[model samples]
Target: MILALDVHYKDDGSAKSVGVLFNLKDSQPKEILVAYLEETDEYIPGEFYKRELLCLLKIVEKVSMHDLEAIVIDGYVYIDNEKRFGLGGYLWQTLNEQIPIIGVAKNFYHGNNETVKQIYRGKSKKPLYISSVGLELDTASDFITQMPGEFRIPHLLKQLDTITKEK
Candidate 1:
């Protein structure tokens, strides 16, 4: 199964994470899992993984690692051409690199053009910045490109964002 994850933070310092499990070709999620935290790390610029990684880890524990083909995160695997670790990268490492991770970022990270592929979807002129670990860059980009959607974000990913933000 492929899992897509997203996290939303509340003003009270609490957080909710949502995961959508599905096959690559599926247009809909097979299972939707959620995890919540009473308090979370404060967002620190240039160290975003610190704030969000725990939220992802909490949701990830709800599923079996052996069954996971890859995990998609709403961020970057590598933040720069030098291959710095991002939220997805930290998750990949925390899993001991057993499962692949694909990072789909709506905004480009400067100096990441060499490592990330810019993929355009639907009628959106802007591209989705794609990065990965434990899989070839092109292969990761292709997977995101093939995800079902009529807009820039894939259906399941967009669904996860909505689910995570629910009160």
Candidate 2:
């Protein structure tokens, strides 16, 4: 199974929603699911990080964390010991070999090389940033191509994000 996850937060830093696109089979469309915590506070740096971990843990516990293909997180992850920090890396460290994580971010600031990089909407624009962490898989471009929309956000995940704010 393939799990495509997009975690979105409010400007103030609260965890607004967590959109998930899952594929139980290889030759099938993805299933959309949204997990939202109604009562939450502003996303302070330390608080946000802790809450983020809790949110992910809750989602995993709600479902089956066994026999999973991948958990694709949307954000940056710095592996090297450089002067930088990453959102996904924190999760990776927390998971601590529990589950394999694949970081598929929209944009990248580091001047480095990636296994997968390509433009989504425009052909003239620079490629998007899609890298892996625990699981060494090359499905970055494939995920973007599978998204049923014309924007950076994926179709199922985007709807999940929108519905999360409806309340």
Candidate 3:
């Protein structure tokens, strides 16, 4: 099973809504889990994982860890060319590096290196930025490229964002 995770923050930044979509292979999600969490830390400029990681972890705990083949996060796995950990990286480490993590970002992270793969979907000239931990970059990119979607973002990922924004 593959888990796609995303979080939506409240306007006041006091709380957040998190969504986890579970799917088998390149299909639609078979299950969707949502969770609400009070923000414990302020969003620091470069350290976004500190604020969002807790919310993701909360939602992850609801699912079976043994069944998870990989986790897809809406950000980078590495913060820079030096391979510094990002939000997805933190999650990977928290899971003891057992499950592979694929980070899919809409925009290019200024700090990422050549390890990041860019994939174009549909007719969009822009590409999605992808990075991974525990899986080869090419393999991760191929998976994302083949995900069930005709637009810029995968359908399940779009659904995850929508569910996260729900009240």
Candidate 4:
């Protein structure tokens, strides 16, 4: 199964809300799981993973890893071309690098390495940034490009963002 994950933070940044959507390959999501967590760490510059990782790990603990084929996150996998680990990369390492992690970002990150792929979807002139660990870059890009939706963002990913914010 494939899972898409996203986190929404309270306005004051005191709490984090997380959403996880599960889907089979090439299919719409079959389930969505949400979690709320108290923020323990401050959001430090260049250290976003610290805050978001806690929220993600909490939600992930509720699911069986054996059923997880890949995890799609709403960020980058690398901070720069130098291969620095981003939130997604940290998650992959924390999980022992067993499950593949794909990072899809709506805005272009200036710090992103050259390895990140730019993909345009629907009729939007803007492109989504795609990065990955445990899978080839092109393959990961293709997966997101084919995700269920005609607009720029995939339906399931947009759903994740909506559900996360609703919490």
Q: What is the TM-score of each candidate against the true structure?
A: 0.98, 0.64, 0.93, 0.93
Error of 4 at 31 (Å): 1.5
Model 3 spans with C-alpha error above 4 angstroms = 24-27
On TM-score, the leading prediction is 1
Q: Write the per-residue lDDT of candidate 4 for residues 2-113, one digit (tens) a residue.
A: 8788887776655555555556444456777777765557889989999889888877887889998899999999989899999999999999999999999888888675
Clashes of each: 0, 1, 0, 2
TM-score-sorted candidate list, best first: 1, 3, 4, 2
Q: Better model by lDDT, 1 or 4?
A: 1
After superposition, the stretches of candidate 2 with alpha carbons farther than 4 Å from their true spots are: 8-14, 24-33, 38-48, 79-85, 110-126, 137-153
Superposed Cα RMSD, model 4: 1.6
Write model 1 residue lDDT over 1-167, tens digit each, in one string. 99999999999999998999999989889999988899998888899899999999998999999899999999999988899998888999999999999999999888888889999999999999999999998999999999998999988888888888888
Candidate 1 wrong stretches, greater than 4 Å: none
- Candidate 3 structure quality by residue, lDDT tens digits, 59-89: 8898888988899999999988899999989
- Cα TM-score of candidate 2: 0.64
User: What stretches of model 4 exceed 4 Å from their correct place?
Assistant: 24-28, 111-113
Alpha carbon lDDT of each predicted model: 0.92, 0.55, 0.85, 0.84
lDDT tens digits, residue span 9-96, model 2: 6655455445454663333235555566654555575344555666665555555667466676665554333613355667667767
Worst 10 residues of 2 by lDDT: 24-33
Q: Which one wins on lDDT?
A: 1
